[model samples]
Target: MIGLNHYLIISGLLFAIGLMGVVRRKNLLMLFFSTEIMLNAANIALAAAGHFYNDLSGQMFAFFVIAIAASEVAVGLGLLILIYKKNGTLDLDDLATMKG
Candidate 1:
């Protein structure tokens, strides 16, 4: 049967993958996606713990995290779109020399 350990392990793996993507990807969109993944991993862990402990607080926190992640995605995507339009590329290296 699946247990807390299993959930924790899965969450850990997901978080690691997200971290790698955030570190290695050069695209701004991919970086945002990676951050979302990490947030989801935290949500999963929180929900799992809430279930295991029969408590509501962890689940509530997970909901809050989800809301925050959604807002972050919306804002990040908007900014990325503007940046892409202005620069014509999503490459981080190319954006490094950006000036106002």
Candidate 2:
């Protein structure tokens, strides 16, 4: 049967992958995606724990995390697009030169 341990392990793996993406990627868009992955990992873990413990709080928190993630992706991508249009590149290093 699927259990809390399984969920936690998956969550840990997801978080690790996300962390790697965030640390190793140079594109601003990829960094945003990595952050979303990390957020999703936390949500899954929270939801799993809620189910395992028969408590609703964890699930509620997970929902909030999802909402926040959605908003982040929207605003973050918008900013990335603006940067790319202005700089002609999505590379994080390129963005650093933004002086306006």
Candidate 3:
């Protein structure tokens, strides 16, 4: 049967991929997507652990994480929109001019 180990392995792999994406991508939008991916990986792992242990605690914690992630996305996207309005591009290097 599918087990906690399998779930953990998959979660770790997904988190690594997300981290690599965040590190490699230059676009701010893609960076946000990568962060979302990492959050999802955590969710998967938490849910799996909750199920394997026959407890609701982990699941509830995952839900809280989901809520926080959703809020983060909302605020992040709003800022992105503002940034896009102020600047014509979303490139990280292009944003360097904003710093002192």
lDDT (Cα) of model 3: 0.95
Residue-level lDDT of model 2, residues 12-83, one tens digit each, is 999999999999999887888899899999999999999999999999999899898889888888988888
Model 1 per-residue lDDT tens digits across residues 1-100? 9999999999999999999999999999889889989999999999999999999999999999989988988888899999989999999999878576
| lDDT to native, each model | 0.94, 0.91, 0.95
What local lDDT score does residue 67 receive in model 2, on the 0 to 100 scale?
A: 90
Mark the regions of model 1 whose C-alpha exceeds 4 Å error after superposition.
98-100
Q: How close is every model to the real structure, measured as TM-score?
A: 0.93, 0.90, 0.93
lDDT of 3 by residue, 1-100 (tens): 8889999999999999999999999999999999999999999999999999999998999999999998999999999999999997888889898687
**Best model per lDDT:** 3
